[model samples]
Target: MFDYADLLTYVLLVLKRAKLPQHENTRQVLRLVHEAAAEQNVPVRLASDLSQKNPFYALLAESSLIQALEIFAKGAHRCA
Candidate 1:
């Protein structure tokens, strides 16, 4: 389990390592996570285990993390 900050940092690291463009959608998803964390008034680390049972997981789906990952995958594919 990790906090929102950890999640954001991981994503940033991936983007940097992959040299993927930080598209608006990616930013929006990050923003949604931030907002959700704030709204829940709980540390995301405590609230999330990256499981489907958590609110964070629902937010991930709603915010389209998979799409963001797909974008990253496409960028990596291009580089390859």
Candidate 2:
């Protein structure tokens, strides 16, 4: 089982690859991460868990907007 941080990293990577800018929803995303983590009975946060080598950060740094869009589209379908 991946940690909340790892899962969050995955989500962030996927979102970035899908090309959807997160905008000012960091707090909301954090809340959702907290809720999701709680449901899994684990506790973690973005600031606390993220390290210098965060894969999610790498993806964002590269800023592949089109890829981010695709990833997000798939995610949206799943959620819907």
Candidate 3:
């Protein structure tokens, strides 16, 4: 399986690049990502290129971002 920390870092970087106003939900997601990364000790892998066509890139809406974070959290737990 892919490394959740790396994925979280990637998502965090994307959010950083977005330069969007920080809403509470966004802050929560960021907090979760950091917590998850600290909890999960997975080996690092080379970063994979995300295609612009990916659904994630297309939908940066809050709902979609929350759902993505939820999935990552679940996956991280399973890995643990």
Query: Considering every candidate listed, which one attains the maximal lDDT?
Result: 2
Best by TM-score: 2
C-alpha TM-scores of all predictions: 0.21, 0.24, 0.22
lDDT of 1 by residue, 1-80 (tens): 45554465444543444232343346544554565545544344432333212122222445565665665564432111
- Report the lDDT tens digits of candidate 2 across residue range 14-40: 344423235355664455555554554
Which residue runs of candidate 3 sit more than 4 Å off their true CA positions? 1-24, 40-80
Sort by lDDT, top down from the best:
2, 1, 3
Q: Which ten residues in a row have the lowest lDDT in candidate 3?
A: 48-57
* Poorest stretch of ten by lDDT in candidate 2: 49-58
Tell me how far the alpha carbon of residue 18 in candidate 3 is from the true structure, in angstroms, after superposition: 13
Model 1 TM-score? 0.21
Tens-digit lDDT track for model 3 on 1-80? Answer: 34454465456654465332233345544554455457653233222222111112222444565666675564432211
Q: Show model 2 residue runs off by greater than 4 Å.
A: 1-22, 40-80
Clashes of 1: 0
Ranking by TM-score: 2, 3, 1
Judge candidate 2 at residue 41 and give its lDDT.
38
